[model samples]
Target: MKNIIINFSVMIALLASCSPATEKKVDKKADSTEVKVNAIPAPSPENNTVLKSYIPVDLSTLVPIDVLNTKSTDVYEKYGIEFSGNCYSCDLASLSITKDTMIWTNVCDENDTFKIDDFSYSTEGSKTIVKTSERTYIITQIDKAPIYELVVEGKKLELNNKRVSRYFTTKKALSLFKEHDCGDFEG
Candidate 1:
């Protein structure tokens, strides 16, 4: 009886070790297959989807003299421009361009704003105000039309040319402008 119990214990230990070895082999195979799948080449830039074209601009050149005369919010209100294209909207506000990336803040309202922090080159054209940003905005200057293209990360986003009226009374529109931080209105 004692010999049989010892034999049973040894067998159980051997089976446990074998199971782990089999599992390790399976895991190694799966890892190799995953590596092989990941080795496939990504698409070339030329074969990539349509991209937006961002023209680097000098911010100093676009700053108007009148900017000092009025509040920043008022200045943006007087000259702010937006673009609509495809199904997206883009507002052109304060733009800072670096060697690698262009930092653009969209003046959505008098205050509410968002930044396009990681914009790079794209195939789509840009539509911008003549004196606001140095980049020429090239979309039909109509009430509703597709405007410029802004590429964030690797994705292309369209800027529609939609002007916000100075006399807009909608509560949402008012709130958007107030929420958008346009820097110091006094300075």
Candidate 2:
């Protein structure tokens, strides 16, 4: 019995030692804050570097000011929702939705402005529709993101909540639209 126990212990020790070792290679680059692990490098925890990337803002985090209905006002609170690509035929539109007003601006006539009223909200199939005299917007949820589709003058442009920069006032939104290039809208 003693011999059998000794043999089993020896086998267990041998098996434990025979396991493959994980290769941990840490490469530190000069003049850089990030450390390289294997080939994919990530921000080091020690440096506390913030990774700059585009993250979609949640609509539930909006101030929740009830301008129209709960559904319409929800969409209205999002700031700086714009089309993601280049459209040469039509001016790129950036929209900022406030508690009381909806501000829409394009590349051309950055100085000029117009106020849209006569707002109406409805639902068609899976889409929630908001319309003004100037344009029509269809709101729908695709995956986890709410998609805002603007239909104006027979041209359709899609804006997503992913580009929303911050929950800002109407003045800040208007200033950003006027100061920045049409394609250069950050929010």
Candidate 3:
């Protein structure tokens, strides 16, 4: 009976040592020994790099204008314009102009036709002449640096430098407009 008791005690001690609580502690210690890795930051551009690129314009602050009427202050309200090229990709395009400034936005992309909206062009030195919906004129004395932004699938991507031109290709531009049935403006 003494031997039996001794054996039972040993078994009980072994079982206790192997309990779930003890196993969990061992697991926690193992987890703590694991190393966590973080992502590295992207490298900055070289100091000598030159950047020149067109950015999409913001149009919320300006009023729309008829590209045809140079004298009227009447704002032109339309859905948007489509512009597609190897250089730009967007879904919609719009133009809004005030006395001195213009704002624009690109809304969608079909094949290559990227939509632009809220686009503004300076009418200060430019003369607006009545033209068809497809043909309108805003002759600027000096081409200004226009700001532009791109939205793709609800994700906004900005093209800040001309060096990024390599990312856009003619094939992609044609695909954008071709998908939308917009005439091949690139040709």
Give per-model TM-scores.
Answer: 0.26, 0.28, 0.21
lDDT tens string, model 3, 1-187? 9999999999999899789788999888777655221222222232112211121222222211112333543222111122342224433333333333333333232232223343333222222221222433333212121112221222333422211111111222223222323345543
The TM-score that candidate 3 achieves is 0.21
Candidate 1: how many backbone clashes?
21
Model 1 ranges with Cα > 4 A deviation = 41-187
- What lDDT does each candidate get? 0.35, 0.36, 0.31
Give residue 20's lDDT in candidate 2 (0 to 100): 30
Top candidate on lDDT is 2
After aligning candidate 3 to the native by TM-score, how far in Å is the CA of 36 from where it should be? 10
lDDT tens per residue, model 2, 83-113? 3321232333345443234444443334433
Model 2 stretches astray by more than 4 angstroms: 1-90, 98-100, 107-112, 123-126, 133-135, 152-187
lDDT of 3: 0.31
